[model samples]
Target: MTAAPNTTKPSGQDSPSTDTAVLRALRRIRVPQTQRNRELFLLIFAFLVNGSAIALVQLGTMGAIDAAFLFYCGALIVLVLAMHIVLRLFARDADPFVLPIATILTGLGIAMIYRIDIAVELGGWDAYSTKQLAWAAIAIVGAIAIVILLRNYRVLFRYTYIFGLAGIVLLILPIIPGLGTDANADVWVSLGFFSFQPGELAKISLAIFFAGYLVRTRESLTAVGTRFLGMTWPRARELGPLLVIWLISLGIIVLQRDLGTGLLIFGMFVAMLYVATGKTSWVIIGVVLAAAGAFLASRVLPYVGGRFSNWLDAFNPEVIDRAGGSYQLVQGIFGLAQGGLVGTGLGQGRPYITPLSQSDYILASLGEELGLIGVFAILCLYMVFTSRGIRIGLAGQDDFGKLLATGLSFTIALQVFIMVGGVTRIIPLTGLTTPFLAAGGSSLVANWLIVALLLRISDAVRSRPRVVIG
Candidate 1:
């Protein structure tokens, strides 16, 4: 009645303007500046500590900064600066935890790589420290750019099929005529002066595809189908898709002759399926199928069969001396055993004795030089990393976020387990890189991208506004 007595309010009473609203919204958006600063500080500290330590060791050995040492130090400084700039430019909003972890691990990796390089130079194999520094610089730039540009991981779901197909093609491309190069353990693409492993990229893409696919299909995959002995099996149609993936994975193992990457990819799928569907039976089924495939592979594929045999007879008189198979493993065990409790000191041990010491056998090198204490530190870092990753997965608000985090975390866990287990004789040899610690361009870049994805997911999870619904 009577326009509610002009309850709208008198003159001079007004709400905030559009401009004010914009400023207020910006304030509410938490720019992640403080976290970024903390990461920057940590990166600087780690770089200084690691770089200075290297200099001190070199100085002690060669007695002061020689021309080669100066050149190396100058190059390293420039590269580190470049990488730092790249991180600031692209990953400004990334989760604080990722960059610091990356920095610490990268520092450790560089130190180890350089340590191996010095030994290799003395042995006439032409050490790769320079090239490794270059690769690390490029990887850091790429990681930052990816985190900045690809803010929404969900966009990957749109191109899941394309990514999956391309990934499969890449995994098998190593078997293609004139394209693949069998670098000791197999799985590499030789491009003249620069060789790269496509499986590194393929693994990440496939994990994305698997996560997106499994999350979408878990409902049907877990639904009760036909009952057998009081147990419900997935529908035939549902099983068909999984079987196809399994076959593809096995094909990678056989054709590419890379059991490590094959097992990694398969483990990713199985883990994601279990996480998405919450079905233990699916895991059991996947394991059984994997064992059956392994049996068949052992009998058929000579290379695979040899690997299993080598793993079995690792200490046998006949297998211990062969350079191609058991030599590295035997040397690795010897090195670790020599380290015992106190290690041989940083630059004192002969880690380069093992083939591919900077890459696949880096763990062995670490064990020899760092000893049990240093190796334990490395293990603790991984444990911290996994614990943080799992926290991110649990904190994520959406299904895709959860799956992505879980898949990434599980992938790292599996890689570490396979590598450490192989070196420690807990499992058969699998030539997988120790993430962040291994020396390979493709691996470094791929792993950095993984860290970026986790950072992005963590940012989303952390920034999400809570709401109450009745």
Candidate 2:
């Protein structure tokens, strides 16, 4: 009772102690400010590079700057600035390099699209470049909304099953009779004036689902069941999830007729699974499954078989001359060859001579115009972006965040590899877009969403208190 009576301090003395405690708490919780400044500076440079590319395209093509270019540039700047503001408000401690890298890639894509539009004499709203700019704006808005709404990446873990269900629904949407649109691949869903690839959104939803699912089941998955060639493998029963995913991927390839997306989705799952379990055996199993899937698809599916044929005999006279043959592949190769050491200068190249110059074969068009050096620079940008995302994943404090980041980052890397490798004849072309550098609205939206998620994760990781092991 005496000790309790002496515990109460004077109000005057208590006020100072309370204030000191408050200051200390504030110091601990205060967001890091320097990273944002570096991001801002890089963003400015990205904008300059983007603007210059547009200007150069205008000057190189039309010989003068036009009102359309100016308007698009102004709108792009405003949209990006708004995104930057939103980031500052919600993700103050996010990675500094991701946003700028995405911006530069998007801008470069638009510039290239615009250049192609001019070459094709496509003006007004009919221009692919105009559509690209609009999509870019929409993508920025989507990113902003994601940052504001999903302040914590961990909240996604609460609805893991819901995300998985949503992803399945999205994947099947493109195959629905009335809703589906038949393009080169049966992957698009049309709603009157708008057509979209649901697979893009499906990828994001699936990544979340996979991250959460693996986190909850990591112990069982990682428990060693068998040993072979100095590696411990999971039990056959433990691989039910992988088998299900692989079958779904095969279905995508066979039914939807999109080998690229099938490969992309399957590859992402394998990458995430390996990271979660830290098992090379899972990778071996995945590769074996992938090889089997590819072999089966090549034999049974005409589209998949055609891709293999194109890859193997692209320059063959009969193969190149046949309808829906290797003509596109050969043209892409020639375009790259034309580029050589240095590109033919943006507007000077005949990139439009190749089909889908602004979409599927856009990289070839870019290679033809930017040369090997420019392609190298663009590849370097992708390398940095992917590396930063992996770094964020590695630094994550939670298993879900790490897997999600890794899956998303690996998705980008895989898509880039598929596109580049296909175009270079290192693999069969899969018709996947080159991430932020492509002319597809669906791709741009999906990629920007990824950037937003990575930003949120990075902010959480940086803001969280670190544990120092003594």
Candidate 3:
């Protein structure tokens, strides 16, 4: 007080008070500790519980609780460590809840597969459950690597067409001799040690392409065009590309007997169109187009006609006689019946008896074991996830981000609806997999990649500075 000399420090000198304020601000902005950690721990717990339940069921089947217990414990430890290490890399920006949700779905799928394996083993047949477990491990590692490596979403926009071409190529690859196997006309490629389905990748790559393309053309598409029926119709010239794509996709369905994948791709296109135009009229047009296409296909394509016929008479005993068509639907319906309300418990239901139990009919198996409640829970999870995606789309800073989010979100929404509708008999059966829950390498990998992109866009939204307008 006598002099208080030099109390005002040099401008370059750090003020302890200022430093404390900055640090406090940073702490406030840091990731929420409770939310993030809680989600992670819950997923880890889910993984353990799922594995243990699988082992218990397997042991109950084989009367070898000790061995199954040991194996289950080991597998759980491996999966958790693998997932943790993977998430540590690229998923840092992902929603705190995304990984946890994925974890539960993935873990549950594995458990169901393991349960099937035990049942098959008891019948003296080779069990693929162990193989499925191996694939799950691979998928987790792949997801982590993709998230870490693909740190930028903008790159996708740049290479959307290229990726789309690659996806189309992959889809057509199964037609190659010695490379593709025909399964009811839908080509399945054998990758020597493992077989891969290209349809999954096609869905994602095409979505990227659609997002980039639609974002660029949306304004034009919605702008001046021949006004008809109180709507701004896109010029025939402007609509040509979409028609070509629709035809190509339709051709694929008719030619390859891959109705489910074709329907999914078409649905993606229609949804993108609706988003771009924001026109209810376009939806009506789309439905009309879809109906027309379906009718034409049924009139021309044998498989399509047969499927439509089978769908029309689902309850007829004669319809269920067809191995390539209605049998799965009939069985799936019966399985759901078996799982009326609360389910038969995780390992108790007869899910494995259904053909294609791990693919399109996985939902049926899920319903059989987990019951209607479980199905509802899963649908709710998808709904929540979709809602978050929509929020991200709306909050995105650019057209590309918004379209990307919307397209990706709608892809999932439509796929879930189609598959769930198929399983519940609300609609004719479409052989589409449940996104994260289905057991397929390509589907699993592609879906996780989608999650990664969504997370990146979401982070961009979250990290954006608040804008104050005068």
Candidate 4:
């Protein structure tokens, strides 16, 4: 009788021992309906916050709630609901907080920009607020398309080098003779009717290249290195990838006059390298290399040196009064001081006194209006967004997804640091738009696309198929 016992074990969850009773096979799924529900709830609050802020802006600045503004807000809210419905069907398991946080930040920026328009007495389609709204609409459409069409982001891995080349071409486009605008920084491309910053999209392409390349070459990077300063440094041969990226970054800084973007691109790679290798030495090497490049640039380029001087002696009478002086910097600082612990209450503050309030100085303008408490809230939103993004990367089952999610998320966080550091006088100022909160068509589109990518990644991480038997 004992010979009747079989000894084969089941590879799947359906073990023979469960044959005593009826085994009901059920597939367990998580975070589709629930994630979407959470997002919908958060979206309600976001809508309320944005609507209140806009209503208050009109009351404080125009002394009446314009019927048209209410209609406009209602239309935007409807558009957002449509987006939510689309996300539910497409990226059902995406991080719930990411979209809502972006929604609030963009709304608050528009509210502030609208108030500024009143202060400057600009109106109609010419106002930056109007243009920003149009851009936001276009960006949302682009984001939706990505989320829907790019069901499997892994396809991008196949075109790694192609993305890298595209990134190079984009970086170069803004420097081409006829295409580049006549701005102080050669970072924009003009196509007759509209202008764009190619660096914005270049970020996405380059990040993909970096993630894919590192995923394949991580073993080589981590395998062989020389010991130096109590740490393992990459061998001269292993250093090729890093050196190439560094040189390209330097070229951007020196040629395009885009110090922020150059820094953004290089810093992104350094962070990704650390993620790939799990070594502190790479970070140290990155800092050293960046400092060296910066010092060299300061010597070769007068503007770079001037930026450093402004950072150091912004209050100097000679520096403040110069043609391209620190007047704006000083004015922004005074605005922050005026904001105190609590801001001057929305549109009541004179943020127009600060130059470039709607763009580069948007944070200072917000600080002057909403105060320190508001600024901290905004920063906290960024922290949440970043944490969610990093969490998605950590939860990924594939190397490429892990590196890509983490790298892109780190880029957003790095950009925040760069912008905030400049505004608070923690670093030399360079032009980098605040994500989701600055008035730029290019930036808005890029930001939404980044959000879409993160959403896609998070969904992929959570929605892997599973089978169970009991």
Stretches off by above 4 angstroms in model 2 are 1-31, 464-470
Clash pairs, candidate 1, are none
- Residue-level lDDT tens digits of model 3 in 74-111: 66457555655554454443466666666667767766
lDDT of 2 by residue, 208-262 (tens): 9999999999999998688878888789899999999999999999888999989
- lDDT (Cα, 0-100) at 13 in candidate 4: 60
Q: Candidate 1's residue-wise lDDT over 219-331, tens digit each?
A: 88888777776666677787777688789878877777788887888888888888888767678778998888888888998888878877888888788776556878888
| Per-structure clash totals for the candidates | 0, 1, 0, 0
Worst 10 residues of 3 by lDDT: 461-470
Alpha-carbon deviation at 204 in model 1, angstroms: 1.2
Determine which window of 10 residues in candidate 4 has minimal summed lDDT: 20-29
Per-prediction TM-score, please?
Answer: 0.85, 0.92, 0.86, 0.93
lDDT of 2 at 165: 99
- Model 3: what TM-score? 0.86
Compared with the true structure, all predictions reach lDDT values of 0.76, 0.90, 0.73, 0.90
